[model samples]
Target: MAKYGIIRMQKFHKDAITGIQKHNQREGENSKNKDIDSTRTMFNYDFVNEDKIKYHEEIKKMTATRVKRKIRNDAVLVAEFFVSASPEYMHAMSPDEQRKYFEAALDHISGKYGQQNILYATVHNDESTPHMHVGFVPITEDRRLAAKDYFHGKTKIRRIQDDFHNYMNKRGYDIERGEPSELQHKSVHEFKKQEREKELKQLEQQVAHKEKEIQRMDSFVELKKAPPVEIRSEKRIEELCIQPIEIEAAKTVRGSKVKVEETDFHELLSFSKELQQTLAAEHERTNALSREIDRYQKENKALKHDLKETKQELQVYVAHQDGEVEKAKKRMREKLVHDFSAEQKENVKDEVKRELDKQYEAHISSLSDDLTIEKQKHEKTKKELVQANKMNDSLTKMNIDYIENYVPKEELDKANKEVDELRKENKTLKAWKEKALNWIDKHVEKIKQVSFFQHVGGIQKRNKRQDQEIER
Candidate 1:
């Protein structure tokens, strides 16, 4: 089979596009080393100007500053459509067929991305394969210069290839569009590797926190009682300062003593309440963290299971790819052999045709010679035929005269009637003979059972052979 066609598009500025146009048109290439056939241009056209000379003037008209929302830099696209010569797709073509193929492909390119966008197209057949290099400005349907809008991603590239492939296939070209690269989806190993790394890091962090929390819980369990909260006795506090001051102020002033005592007790009570609330809040936070950690652990296990499944799928895909590769290789080898044989057969056919043409010329010349001789013989034969016809006419006249004078119609008719009566009598006798034969046939079996049939048919004594021969 012919290999797939390749079309490569490159963005270029006006100057570069011009350079390409010149090179492709055989103006830029060094004339000294170039062959007339090699690097030869089949036809070049400046679609913008509808001229053959220069596309610079044309490019300017197609894209200018006046065009709205235009990209100033990537104004032109130069693309090469490489046709395959292998397996004789290009090699097998007549010059006209090759031209048509390239032209049709160029038309396909233009049709794909609007004909207005194409500035220049030239078919080159002097190369190994018939191909075309076309330069087009990436203009949208609404006529805006937008290269980024079209081929910025692989989606357009794949789609263009698919469309081109279908077109070529319909035109009876033996080629396939390449399978799109699966780079978007990471390989199983790569994905698993990255995922495992992240999972491992998360697992390590969770395990560390879990270990610390377990230790804390263990420590809490080991502790039979809560930490002792220190409290100051009201009497001790009074002895330290208030008692001496109170006594010095008034020895029997009980109301002042009660007021000082009440202030110290209230402060101690508030401190104890705040401490209890802090302990309760910390306990709830720890419980919540533990639950969160357990959930993460379950998630980690599920991820591991998913990773296993992905690996299995990857293995299956790889195996399938391997089988397909082997089959493709086998097909390629077979195709190569077939092509070689077909080419050899074609060469043989050409030689045979050449020989046949020579023979046919000789045969025609001989036939012409024979025809002249035959024509001479035909004239002589015609004379003989005329003489024979005269004799036949004379004989026919004599026969007619004899019939009119000697043989009368009445005598012929009477004889015909008598013959007809004899034929009827013969038919009646045949019918009677058939009935007699049928009667004899019916009685013959019964006659065989009698002594007379035994003597006539040479019947022997009944035995195994006799029973086997006669089914009844």
Candidate 2:
């Protein structure tokens, strides 16, 4: 038989355990160190009973300190029930099944109240009745208890009992009560079992109804007195039942219905044959469509790959073009420098030539002045020569007369020496004039072959090109 109970535990300290032990000692119970099973303890405290102490220790280990203390308080208020079996009721379950049932019950409660509200739960066979002691915290983290708000002065406990009964009934258990109408007396397991049986019966009836309909249709098809038409009229009923009802619902729906004349049976037969042929043709067409879709998908994938490759190739081409552009720019820069240097050289040569021309012109002017002075000196020398010649003639005449009469030898010798020295001076002047004319000839040749003029044409061409470029 299934038993029911609620166990409430409360937090206690070391002092409380000590006090309890002292009270038990006074009552003549030897609460000394003993080898008891540690699993029996509800709270882990240093006590004489090792079993009880270890049991609490395990629970404490599984829970956080705050939650453990809360559940400890809840465990203290639990009440166990020893339900009996009779002809008016039945055993809800055996001891083992009761354990499972209570475990499920506890899980359901935990789900409702939250796991933090429950500390621990255990089945105690040592007790008179095989019952479970469920330990829970009365106060939630938000400081509320289960069913307190809804139940407040109402039959909230009854509601919990009903829900629990329904749960057990669904799991295939028995119900026990004085009368079938006394739902209050029925266990949580019994109520759940009855509800589940009703649901199962309803599901079975639905399945049976569907099966009968299918059988009726199959019978009608078998009894048909006409030849198999190529154009079948099953378009109206194709979706009725190919697979199970659930699978049928998931498939796509085809077209809607249309009215056909029944009086023209021959035409109807002919149309049916045509329809069957059309359906066969459509089946082939659908298969072909599916193949086409697959082919298109493959082509799409290939196109995507080709597009990626083309993009990569384009990128490479762009990079190569960029490189070529850079090279062209570099060449252009170098060429600009070379052309500028050539132009500068030509400009320097022109300036040098101009300066040389100025120097040459000044030299020519000085030469002209020297020539004028030389001509004046030549004229003066010519006049002096003529006067000398006249003087010489006159002197000769005088000398002859003097010689005939009686002249001095010393004076004649001195006159001959002075004449020879005058001749030598005249020859030196003629040589100086020839040297000056030769110097003027060399200067004229140097001016004619000026280096600046040699490159002037080329420099002008380059400058024009540069100006054109700037304008552009």
Candidate 3:
């Protein structure tokens, strides 16, 4: 019976796809753990995006419905479908039939699931038995994502098995379920495993039986040699023989028959010697066979252990690789978002720059107009100060003429005091007008600098500085 074990691939493993690709494409030809000629690509997927980063992008794109902008990082990367049986099951069919069996099996799986879910389907012929390794993403037909869903309950797995078998059988492959004993209930996989174990146990029993037979033969050999040890003395043996010891049909060590009165005694001695020699050879052969079986069993166990360890390491390595790929992808995405933000900021900055420039130009123009008004006001004030000074000078002249000409002393003093007061007030007005003119010149220079910067790249430079700050 053919069996298929559906296994979930660990999330984010680099080896998940890399190793399969190597096996499927025969890339590890010279490596010690090469999968050379072990796999033939029954199907290929162009979706993996030879480029690792791009592959992830493709997955995200294809699964966009299930995987939104924010998807789980620990989503399953792959699932393995191991389909196999003993070599006899596969070799029973012709090459064309074998092809059909695998093709149909995969077709059913793909059809049952979604075709987009399957990544690769490879037929492996390099091991003890012909089998296939299929990799797929755990995506459901309705575009839902969940790796742990399909193999959750017995019903689903059974349906999968039945459907697979149904597909294969319908396509002319004589695949069927194995029979279980009346008192026993077990899965096909378990049954196959127990059957193999039973075969091994039987071989072990055979080895033990051979060892027991060897022991029995050894005991017989020892019994044949017991007569030599039982012979108490040579004198007694001669007396018992009643005459000279004669050997007949008794081969000596030199393969020559000897004549003697005690022919039976010679024969017993010769037989004991031959049996001892035979026993030595038989014991060595039996030990050798036992050692061979032991060694075979030990090597088989070691191979199994090594294979398990290698698989574990492969998974670990792939996981590490996946981390790296994810990290790389993360870097790219961050850079992309960063670049987008920067472009947006640049656009905003441009808009702000235009607005700032417009406001600056309007402000400078307003400042210029105010400066012009202030300058005109200062000129008018200066002219008024000059007129006041001139008027004060004429009053002083007129006061002097009055004081020196024909006025009373008291009246003259009063006029002089009034004229002095008018002169002081005019001087204060001149100082205040000069201060106002200096303030207006200072403000005008500031407005001109503002206008200059507005026309130059000062606004842009300031914006760039702010942008740099924002980036930091």
| Candidate 1 wrongly placed segments (more than 4 Å) | 1-3, 30-51, 74-87, 178-472
Please provide, for model 2 over 232-317, each residue's C-alpha lDDT reduced to its tens digit, 9 standing for 90 to 100.
Answer: 34454243323222212333454243334555545655665666667767767655755665665565555556555655655554
lDDT of 1: 0.54
Which candidate number would show the highest lDDT if scored against the true structure? 3
Candidate 1's displacement at residue 171, Å, is 2.9
Considering lDDT, which of the candidate structures 2 and 3 is the better prediction for this target?
A: 3
Model 1 residue-pair collision total = 0
Ranking by TM-score: 3, 1, 2
Question: In model 2, which regions exceed 4 Å deviation?
Answer: 1-95, 141-151, 176-472
Tell me the number of clashing residue pairs for each predicted model: 0, 30, 10
Clash pairs detected, candidate 1:
none
Give the TM-score of each candidate: 0.34, 0.23, 0.35
- Indicate the worst ten consecutive residues by lDDT in candidate 2: 78-87
* Model 3 lDDT, residue 47, Cα: 26
Q: What is the lDDT of residue 88 in candidate 1?
A: 51
